[model samples]
Target: MITNLERFKREMEPARQLYTREIQDFSKKYDALGEMSMEEFPDIDTQDYIFSFEKVNGASEEELDEIYIEISNHMEEFSRTHGIEKFCQNARIWL
Candidate 1:
């Protein structure tokens, strides 16, 4: 039987592919985002989470902007298809 984690992994492939190379490399470093789960994300809107993600920290602001746009759209779709709680619990935005 496919576990939820496996299913989530499979489901995320296309969204992952849509990510910019910068984001793809970032996500890959997180082990397919196994570490992205939020214990208690305080934001009611995902936009807040996206906007506040990773400091510029010498990274390109242009790159971070692109990452935010991609994540905002993709994450909303994922949450709609899945459930709010499930989706939120599974991923976080950080770099």
Candidate 2:
């Protein structure tokens, strides 16, 4: 089993072009409403959005696992610090 820290570290690496491609593919899946909605934007997912990381950039299962770990850590830190900007900068999973 992979530890949380290990997974987070992996996700923190630079986002490859493949990742962007996946995002684009995701965008195509939705109709005009989904594509035009404010939720479709942003590198991160928000409550209003239905962002998916399943194949973000065509990442493998291992990569997605790492991304999840990184997201979890970011949430934990942000919750404790209450610093959105700093947390966002620190939590950038796309490097």
RMSD of each: 9.9, 15.6
Model 1 has an lDDT value of 0.45
Candidate 1: where are CA atoms >4 Å away? 1-26, 29-57, 85-95
Error of 2 at 32 (Å): 22
Per-residue CA lDDT of candidate 1, range 38-88, in tens?
Answer: 232333232212313434335566665665667656655655664453444
TM-score versus the correct structure, for each prediction: 0.36, 0.31
Candidate 2 Cα misplacement greater than 4 A, ranges = 1-54, 83-95
Worst 10 residues of 1 by lDDT: 43-52
Candidate 1: which pairs clash? Answer: none
